[model samples]
Target: MKWQLAGSLGLLLALALVNVQVDVKGYTRSLATRVLGALTSPTSHFTDLETSETSDDEDAEISDTSETENSDTSETESLETSESEDLETSETESSEMSETEVSESGVYNYEGTEPLDLTQKLMDSANKKEEVRNTAGSEYCLSEDDDPYTGFATMTPYRIASTPLKADDVIPAGCKPVQIWHLIRHGSHGAHRNDYIKFEDELPHLRRRIFRARVHWKGQLCEKDLELIKLWKVSKMMSKTGNLSKEGVEEIAGLASRFKSVFPGLLEKKFSIKRHPGDGNKIAFGTGSQNHQSAVAYISRMYDAYARYVPVGSQPSKTLQFYDYCRNYIEGVLNMDKKLKPYHTFMSGGIMNSVLQSVSERLGFPVTVANVRVMYNACRYYYAWYRNKVSPWCTVFTPKQLKVLEYWEDLRVYHDQGHRFEINSKQACVLGKDLMDQFRNRVENGNTELYAASYFVNPEALVTFITLLGLFNDEEPLNEFYVPKTRMWKTSQFAGFGSNLAIMLSSCVDDSFWVSALLNEKPVQLPGCDSSLGCPWNSFIQYYDYLSDCNFDELCGSFSSQLAQSRHWYASYMNEQWM
Candidate 1:
């Protein structure tokens, strides 16, 4: 008896040890979660209350990296992008407690720091990071030692970059999940033709400057990193500029797999319904091919059948892609000086100036802010596309610097796609109407043919949808004034590529239906969603009820324009007149 008791105690102690939590990539989690994951197969009978399974899915996410266009209008993109307006990455999350009403109040991480002295002696010492590994030609990935992902807006690899949900946070108990509605953006795509051009054309001159410059950079950058930078070769993938990368296909595949595992009943093959372009070519640059490929990659993996799906066209309907028809916005942003003023102001602020000066001094060259921006672009795009690899350019910044850059990207997105204008959010009501309709069907009729509806669109539409639904509304609007580090509108988490907003309908024993919101696989409470029971079915439906018969022209005040932003797949590529 004593022997048995001793063994039991030993086992209990071991379990306790296993339960101790550890922090990973800015997220706090218990090792017990891993222990549970080890014991559970995601494919096994899924319960609405439990899904604590982990795969070699190295993602805090499931992230690992991170766009395009083709049109007659003369293309003129620069370091300052029109946000994700032209980003073509197959790219772009978080777990529990992800949304916290950030539009009004939150702590911004940035402050005006003293400018770096151009004459100050350069140095690289103990402050230089100890880790240095060049992953240019390697397939290596998911190092626990790697720094937490610094979100890079739409360029972010959604899953691999964000933390996962606590298993139990999926759905509340006594709630039987009946259906799922998912709105997904395309996965991390290839670099823009412009960025690719700059990487090939402009970066070499900067590299030569670094190589020939006379100064001490050893203190800021380790020798190995510097060497790797010097030896850096532009990726051959750049040749396929403005299309989805292979990594992007993998992201969609992984998402499809995990979604099924998390809600097996809702996502089963018989219940699955996918609506996206059927083109096999990987779309970017207004081709529906990339979007189609994304849907194929997702559905094929989910059902284990590629040929089952027939061909379809891209989602060019003005309802979801309404930005094309909105004349005020299309014309307003045309004035680069006026449209990008807030972003440009932030970019040229004292804080940004400090960052530019510091990076230039570190490399011992006359690097411009544009150069730093490009280096940042290289780091995010490369890391996003090659989840298993780190970029040599990634070594350029310290953690603090990464945060500053992240905020910079966020500020740009804030104005372009976020709460800057109610018009943007108003345009999203069409999507909101579609989502609530699914839940309403299950509630009113009581489980009519199991439903899993997945729609794919670009980030421009996705962000507007998020805005309309008030998913990440912050207390303070993002501006050149400061960085809201604690805010919910952080695009890296809110709008990453492959990012999704899932609204699930669960039926209760009490004869009521409730809906739960999951943003990029993490549980989040939408404006008035219950902390536990999620949101009541009626409440969910009422929010979008106003869109019963909404019209895009009426919403935008019958606006019309001939200016082609080349942002709309249908309007730009297919020759749809917005008027």
Candidate 2:
């Protein structure tokens, strides 16, 4: 036993030297960890000898010396309380996943060289496709070009200050614009009421803990970020929580200005571009105010004067305010357990565990997943709401950590809004039918009743409409249990504040009307109707979910959901649910 002890100590010393001398790809550091385990139980006789089988690199990584890109490891606060065995099992699963997860899922580089995209990375991880996201990375962030605010998923702001869409020039050469229909999400606004309360109550304690843990943060975080973190405080907006913000108003103004510049003749007062499409609800519920105000602000620049009155929220049930009327979607998806299961599953997974651990170490403190979650929220909201200013909280996380959290938000959105049956067919069809109605009046009948229309609503309705149009659906459905390192369903791009879907009906010299579509000002081909000039009038209408199958009252009825589930159109989705 004495001889065994001496040999083990000598081996440990050798391993330590190797660890110190060679910082080779984290593999050497892992080998030392195995040796340390043996020393803790010398009687085991160094049984963990095989390098391939015994390397546990994904262990307690919140220590000062262990925080690195290759030192990716576990440790997390479960979003919910669970038994000890369950927690242990989750940690174990996360470790295994780290070993097998893909090599390059398109990371956000902190060095400020990556294209500045507000949406998180959307890689097709299942089949290894190129990361797909908005490429308009020119001068959005005031200073740091590589800020990871782009990965905040739904929280990312619409890129208003960047490249203009120039909607007029985008129409195919021979086509003349006849009519346009636009649907926009509400612009940026103050944080949620709950967010304010949580920051006031919870973040202060976390803040002090961060200062106490700063000794451990040496070399982990930069000094400038550290100073800002110490000075950080919850905004005084607490006195009036959830109000429309100045930035949101600016976003709206930018939208109005862009709309006018892109299509001066189309958006004239003679057209149907109303004064304000914002909801009349109180600031707490009136998300439309920010962009609506900003858009109103930009009107002076766009035109000599604006035009007519259309009462916001006055459209038919499930047409403008579909969220309020879609009882099945509200009860089943928003209020029930089904839509959030994927988010909850992802929150408790290995990637999140490592994220929690990484964030904690990166900040020089031990933080619960809840703590990191709040910080992340604050970071995103602040970064998005204030374009010219960078949030202190945003400095707490790296691009990798931001990406993981973004994926968490993506998972929630996928289940709730993206590619869901109700969203694809019922919730989405209300607006789909409305837009098609306008198209038919101009093209098929040449009724000439309307020319252009714009409406603003919440992101929920906007994202669902995008799904109905098949703008960003991935070939592989998102699984709650396993995250695809890359996939196409990205909410940040699809439903950011001020994000919109626009369809233009144009008159071609051939005496046939054609339709073209744009998302966030960029022209894109619809799934079946792929054309540069515009798809034929008939082809575009096929995207709509006909009113015959989607009566507002019937689709919202409890009994109708059962019958709707059995429809041939939903057969594959039903099978997928079981699968």
Candidate 3:
């Protein structure tokens, strides 16, 4: 019986020691407090570091004495002192915490500090961040890395120099044709890119919490933002559709003006203003996947600027899908014949919308009907409702195309005012005919351009060749016909696919072909053609049609007086008869 009591006492002493160890280690001791009763089940202990089991009142009374004795154990006393020392060391290691920092209630116990449960605080922060990311996830923007695409206006200088061929130029080489001209396409629209956006308080308000999560709160370069930026860059650079940008507008317009400068009255002579020539050869042009169509679209938009008025929501004429089909067919025909492939590929409203939506989505906006329609109409209004959406306006000069066309119209109607070089009524009629002919050529040749060539050839062939051709690559002569003021720098330098093709043709046929020379920058004569012959060669290469269109009796009458009557005298006689 004494041994049993002694064993019980030793067990109590062990329990007391365990309680001390647990306390020193900062572990829970509720189990030790209840040891006078039944022990916690192994399963329960496994389930939790600490667990509770009901103890009888009798057992509880026994435990009270055990607890008192435990408090008095030498080991327990030593553990208490050691624990205090450990706590002091821990506090020293974490001494940066300000007094009253992170309060239990979470409210600042002091002006700028409060205590908090670190784990709970971390979890709360994470949740807030997740919420923010989800909220602003829908906006689209371009990143700094994305390349910018300008308008069609950017392409006009090259178009004027390279003079794309027209569809009528497809006739067999053996055929005796007077002249042929054409326009060609370069290529398709560029893809979209990742972009960045600046947001205002109002926009954020509209987006509400979503915007905050996705954009504002997250800041730039966050993982989510980076993902969006990457998506945009890939989509834009690889986009299969859409017109050129504002720069393209200027490109086409500049080309038109340069065309006028190069082939003065080309349109008038083509239309048969001189009694509508009966045997006039056709002019041709071609389009490609997105280029020519975009050109048309660009032109239409440019013309809209001159409209007296435009309907509020009506979209400006942009490229259509059918235009793209037609352009592709034109390119195919040109390619098959090996005559001169014209570029094809124009945009339609659908294509443009698709492009816009794609870009918007990549940027995170996912273009909606409301936003898309609004943007289309707005662009149309801005472009003047020219409505020719087939051509990609993103290249350049589309605006100038509008201006020059308007100028041509004014010149056609009022020829007596010396609007463009003095000419008699007959000369006026002849010029008008030329304009009509050019227009008809475009219409007859499936709405393409003459002198413009389309092909599956490399776009940079001409430009690259010329750039490497000569010793210095350039030479200069003062006021010389084929000389550029800056000296020769490079050759075969054309801007786009159409421009490159034009350069290729001109290079083959013209003797003074300097790659660096601007095709439209100076007046150059074709090889074997003399200035004394009253024929002038200019920057843009001309096909038979272009020359034929300019061969007017009134305009040429003074060249060889013995062979023709004075155009002025003839005009006077005709006018007198009418009077």
Best by lDDT: 1
Q: Output the better candidate (1/2) by TM-score.
A: 1
The parts of candidate 2 lying over 4 Å away from their true place are 1-149, 160-163, 215-219, 236-242, 269-318, 338-340, 422-425, 542-549, 558-579
List TM-score per model, in order. 0.67, 0.65, 0.28
Query: At residue 472, what lDDT does model 3 achieve?
Result: 22
lDDT (C-alpha, whole model) for all candidates: 0.59, 0.57, 0.30
lDDT of 3 by residue, 1-579 (tens): 999999999999999977755553342122222231122122332222111111222223223456446633753455445334433443455435333332333322333444433334333444565566445443322222143222222222242334443322321222212222322333223321111011111111212212222231332223433333222111122223334554444544555444334433232234334433222322122223335444454333323343122121233212111111222221322123312211101112343344445534333444443333222222222232122322211211123223222222222222211121222222223322443455345434534335322121122222322222211222221121121324322222233423422221222123222111223233223333342111222322242233234334334233344322332332342223211
Q: Which should have the higher lDDT, number 1 or number 3?
A: 1
Per-candidate Cα RMSD to the true structure, in Å, reads: 26.8, 18.3, 25.6
Q: After superposition, how far is residue 537 of candidate 3 from its true place, in Å?
A: 9.2
Q: Could you give candidate 1's per-residue lDDT for residues 374-437 as a string of tens digits?
A: 7888888878777666566776666667778888877666676788876767777667767656
The candidate scoring highest on TM-score is: 1
The Cα error of candidate 1 at residue 38, in Å, is: 60
What's the candidate order when arranged by decreasing lDDT?
1, 2, 3
After superposing candidate 3 on the true structure, give the runs of residues whose Cα lies further than 4 Å from its correct spot: 1-254, 261-270, 273-287, 291-516, 519-579
Clash totals in order: 47, 10, 188
